[model samples]
Target chain A: MAQKKNIKNRATSKPSSLVWIMLILLIMGEFFLYAWSRVQCTRMGYEITREENKYKNQMNMRNNLQIELSRLKSPKRISLIAKTRLGLIRPAPKQTVIIR
Target chain B: MKFDNHKQISRRAAIIGIMFAGLFIMIGIRVIFLQTVQGPWLSKKAANQYEKSVIIRGKRGIIFDAAHREMAVSIQATSLAAYPGRIKNKNEAARKLSNILKIRFKNLRRKLETGRSFVWLKRQATPRQVQAVKALNLKGIGFIPEFNRFYPNKTLGAQVLGFSGIDGRGLEGLEFYYNAYLKGSERKIRVLTDALGRQFDTGQTNANGLGGNNIILTIDGNIQYITETALEEAAKKYNAESGIAIVMAPATGAILAMAHYPFFNPNAFNSFSRDRWRNRSITDSFEPGSTMKIFSAAAALDSGICDPNTIFYCENGEYRIGRNIIHDTKPHGWLSVQQIIKVSSNIGTVKVAEKVGGRSLYNLFKKFGFGNKTGVDCPGESTGSLSFYNKWSNIDKGTISFGQGVSVSALQLTSAAAAIANDGILMKPYLVQAITDQNGRLIQNFSPQKIHQVISARTARDLKRIMETVMTEGGTGVLAALEGYTVCGKTGTAQKVSTHGGYSKDKYIASFLGFAPAKKPEIVILVILDEPKKEHYGGIVAGPAFKKIAHQTLQYLNFTPLRQKKHQRVLAENEVSG
Candidate 1:
């Protein structure tokens, strides 16, 4: 009876030690994932900030170019160019046709 | 010996224990005081050291025409600045910068030598100048992006657009009127810094939040250009002091164009005087000569006082009213109301006003939107002087009938005429068509609003026919007649009020108010020329300009000419018969 009791105690001790080892491994894996994700998030934050600035600068540049185009296409400037450089003149009243 | 040693050691232990208790009590008191008394203050100080704040100016809104063409735009420009503390060789820096920026060398050197940590070298530097400065790459020099207001059309609609100062504050015109909506809000961004005062990256946030809303005006760019070119020519040709031309959609009271002579470029507004910047269409009032007859006729006809054929003897061109004799440009007898308006007879108009009486006439003028604000979406509109009927003398009544004693702004006169063209329903004039956000989403839309019905449809129709006669062969405004379209118009040649209190014989204001396609009018135009030389008559000076603007506007609007429509109808009839 004494020998049987000692064998059961040893058997329970072996499984309990394996369970403890698995728990320790799982915890280590979680910690490693958390640290790696934090590093990636920080790097991406810098990248997004730099990209946002580039986008803003590009938008401003496009707006400036559009303004330049509008200035060039202004009616007064067009008329001046037409009259002086292109030597164009307005048509007489009869020259224009009216379609009903 | 052992007993004496024990007593000495016990005494030493007691002394050290007392000293340790005192130190613990002092440390506890200090910790409590620091945690409670100075906590808030010290935390704020620490935050100030570790945080960085940057002020980003909001971008101003752009102004557009009806067709979404840019009238005024804001462009990003670089402003040059300096850190005076970091600047070395201040004299050299100033000399080099002044040459590039065209600033005074001594003044710039003095600014750079100041004790201030930062100083503005130039606000809104040109791209060329910015590039030149950047090439120098001088120490302590910095460049910051700023928005600068730019008018693409230069002087095309200077008075309407107004201008913004270097600091982006609206100074005049629509810019001043809609300043609250046009000027943008400022933003402050706070960043977290580490222990050594280095900022940590905050993920991409919209750098430009909500900016000021943009405005789209009711003005058509092409129509405005046409009107401006024509008015400029008329002013230059006649050698007039100044001139104004207004084109309005009679039905909706939408002012398609409002132009004034002697225009100035908004980009260089400082070089022009204050007078040149005034929008004379609404800001300036003048005695509208015979243009008042049209309103007087409406009052008489609407009140059942007279018919189109009611006859009145002209007194052979002279009429005496309360110690004053009013003279006509020419003598006429037995003239009907229709004929009177065709000739613009002063005696005939006075007699008609007498029949309508002063009370009715005053009410008529008030109802026509004179002597009051037209409530146009423009700044500095004048409420023209209209004395009460009780205050009118006999001479005042007679002269007011012929548009001498009463004064009116060009906008009021044109709007009133537009009411008549719109079958007597007065519409409040508006310029801004819509307000939009930075992303081009519509925030608010302004539609046409009818102020009130000023006259009956029957009365407006009768007046249109009578005014049509005034543009016919024998009328004073014959020059205003269009070949392919029917025109209803009135002419006015008022002697300008002299500075000394009487009418000036040499100076006259020549004006014409008219609308085309008399049966169903689309547009009403008003042209006024001040102190036109050689010819003082409205028919000669302003009548032809009225014709040109009307014809061009009708063509631009694609209104089918009367002949073309009639011919098309005939062809359709023949096709059906075959």
Candidate 2:
């Protein structure tokens, strides 16, 4: 009778399909969470890069404008214009007054 | 049996643990190597792969007058640039900008289509135009903050103040002289921003960021204005080709006002020509005519070679020296050296020069700061011309005796004249009073620096007395008299040298060098008018201008004569110096 009972218990110990399904689900869940966070991180990084590029471009334009402004103000250029364009002359003491 | 088994197990366990400890040590050593030596290299490699750095620029400094008035300043401006690759609608952007900024739309469109990453749509746009562009909110269109120089005073003291470039650096005058002290320290910062574009503090920080310094000039704005105004009026009234005026403190050498005609506004620098932009006070050189006699006379007095009572036998107004006949406007038989200077007698000054000798006169000229730079801190300064004594020609010496055959800048002439006003002490001509940092700490200070006492106090006093006589009825001193004020001055009508070596026939530089209250002068004024169309005589063309200007200046400074009571003195009391 004991030998017959041992044979019956061994027959009932085969692996169930439900255990395999549960293990697959756990691995898939972790992978999905990792993928989602990675997408979020990449998006954040892209935004920062874009903002930096924008600032860089703005600064370059500013530099160019500053150069233009200075070029316009050079003494040589102004003097050229004043002498050729405007009919002006130096002042004289006889014409102007001197006060203490 | 269990105890024996336990002892064997413990011994085996200890042996295995020692092997594990060695493995752990090996891994720890690897980590130390990676962190200590290779970390920087790896980090740099990583940065090279992903990071890009661009240099940031510093803003230039603003310009201000002595009165703390903004002569030039930075205003927020925008530039329109295009990302050629990103520009999907070049025509649209150009049209929009042209409409908003009033730019040449066709030109801008052509620039945008050049297939470059960046094309400037506009530079230095006004605030309204920038706002207009921003309102459009167009994509790929951008603006950068920039500063532009503005001149609020227009053409006032334009040459003296000079013009700045886009970088806001001084190119001339006070601007160039104090450039180093004006340019401030620069700084850089690594910044972090949040999603809302607000500035966020980063643990990483940097210093070395700085703004420009401020310069406090010795020029008084009101004085400059009045001086310039009077100069303008005189130039117009006299129908003169060019004119220059300067007001300075006799003792301190502090330049209060320097006025020149044909000045150009720094903002509109391009609108004028270079010839009109120089400060004549320092740049232009001419024979000072009678003004030169004052120096010669002072030299004779200081060296005890001649005194006020010294008399010279005049050859009835015409004298011959070394095959050259020198003539005076009026011939007097006998005259004292003092009377000669008082009358501005060319023949008389020549006689005095003969007795003093040429070398003595030249040495005196050097002592009086002629033929040398005034040591003024201005660029383009020309040291007046003094032919070497060793190289002197007899004719040159004779001509130089009466203010010819040599040249002196307006600065040199005026400064020498100032010596007499300041009791014979020559002072350095200073334009900038002080230089301060951004926080207003003084970096430089200019005080009353005396070059030397070129003449004794008594000599100066005597020269003053002689100059006083020139303004009186006895001399060519009719036009330069200031009513109610004791005026002493000299009149000069120098024949301008022709480029061909002789004097120009019609062209003359008429000038008057004068100071007030002969006993104790508070101000010294030198006026020069080149090629006057009306009266060419220094006393007539340059003199009346002196009277008018001096009158206005005295009122401006609240100056009153020493002997005359305020408002009680008659106009006759102020007679023209002879």
Candidate 3:
């Protein structure tokens, strides 16, 4: 009878040790996942900042180019070029034709 | 002895247990105190380590012309700043920056060596300079983004658009008037920084709404350019002290062009004199000279006191009133009002003024918007002087009748002429057409406003006919006549009020005020030249410019010549007959 009791006790000890090992593995996995997510969040933050800066720079460049285009299209400059470089003159009143 | 030893051991164990319990209780109380009493302060202190609050200013608004062409724009530029205490090897940094920035070495060095904790190295640095500085990667130097106002057309409409200062405050012109709407608002935002003091998060802030609302003006850029060119050429040709020209749409009262001579670039406004910075057309008033005859005739005709054919005996070149002798440029006999206006006879105008009476003429001038501000959107509008009829002596009435004693701004005269052109209805003049957001959404629209009618439609037509005679062969404004279009105009030559007291003998303000397509006038143009050296006659000096501007503007408006219209009508009639 005593030998039977000792066998039963050994069987219970084996299951408990297995359960302990499983719990420990599960905790380790959770820690690693939390750490990985944290690192990803930080990396994404840096990337977003870089992209925002690039977007701002591009917007500035567009504004500058638009201003430059306006300057180039100024009437004074166009008229000057037309008169001097292109050798053009404004048509007289009678020379111009109007389409109905 | 054994039992005694057992009791002693029990006592010692119990005392040590109590001591350990007391120590734990103290620790618990301390924790509670820290959590309750100083939690918020500690949390804030921790946040300061990696978080910052920064103030951001929105970009200033843009100014667009009638056709949506950019007149003034704001662009992002980098400003260089320095921490004097953090800078090492200041001499080398200053030397390098001086070369790149085109600043004097001594000045740059002095700025760098200042005792202040922070100082501006340069404001609104060029892109090339910023690039050179960044390439150097010098310590303690940093760049701040700022908006710089740029006038793309330079001097095209400088006096109208005005300019803003470095701090983004408007100091003159429409800029000064609309500064509140053009200036951006300030916003505060929180940002997260990393250990290296680099921003990692921009935080939750919508910055787009903070920018100023953009302005759209009624000024036509092409028309403004044409007017400025013509005015400059005319002023230079005549060697006048200054000049002003205004173009207005008769029906809408939209000022298409307001040009001032001696132009200055708003981009470099500081380099020009303050005198040149003024929009003289709106700010300064001058005698309209004989141009006032058109209004006088309108007054006489509108009051039904005199018709276009009312014969007034012009004193054959000179007429006496009280103590003053009013002389016509040339002798005139018993001339009808039409002929009198054609020749710009001063005596005839005075006689018409006499029949209309001082009170009636004053009321007419007031009705034409001579003595009050037109309430134009531009800054610094002058209410041209028109003394009360109660204060007018006989001489004042005669002089005022021919535009000698009274004064009128270029804008007021243009608007009054526009009233006549619009067939007796006076429309309030305006420059700004609308206000828009950054995304091109309409915020507000300025529509045309009509003031009271100054004359009856029939009288306005008769007055237009009499005025058209001024552009005929014997008229004083004969030079201002367009080849294919009928022009209604008046010429004015008023002697300037001499500094000593009376009118100057040689100095004169010669002007031409007129409109084209007399039957349905589309545009009214007023051109004035102050102190012309070449000639003092209004027709000789200012009539040609009036003609050029009127012709070009009418052509631009796509008005077909009367002769062409007639030919086209004839062709259509023949086609119908077939």
Model 2 spans > 4 angstroms off: A1-100, B1-76, B193-209, B563-578
- Each prediction's total of clashing residue pairs, residues at least 3 apart in sequence or on different chains, is 0, 37, 0
Give the C-alpha miss distance for residue B435 in model 1, angstroms. Answer: 1.8
Candidate with the greatest DockQ versus the true structure: 3
lDDT (C-alpha) at residue A64 in model 2: 51
Instruction: In model 2, state the lDDT of residue B44.
Output: 78
**What is the per-residue lDDT of model 3 for residues B265-382, given as tens digits with 9 covering 90 to 100?**
9988999999999999999999888999989999999999989999999988989988779898788889998998899899999999999999999999999999999999989999
Best model per lDDT: 3
Error of 3 at B66 (Å): 1.0
Deviation from truth (RMSD, Å), model 1 = 4.6
Per-candidate DockQ values are: 0.40, 0.03, 0.73
Candidate 1 chain B minimal-lDDT segment of 10 residues: B196-205
Q: Interface Cα RMSD for all candidates? A: 2.4, 10.4, 1.2
Off by over 4 Å in 1: A1-43, A81-100, B1-50, B192-201, B574-578
Give the TM-score (vs. native) of candidate 2: 0.75
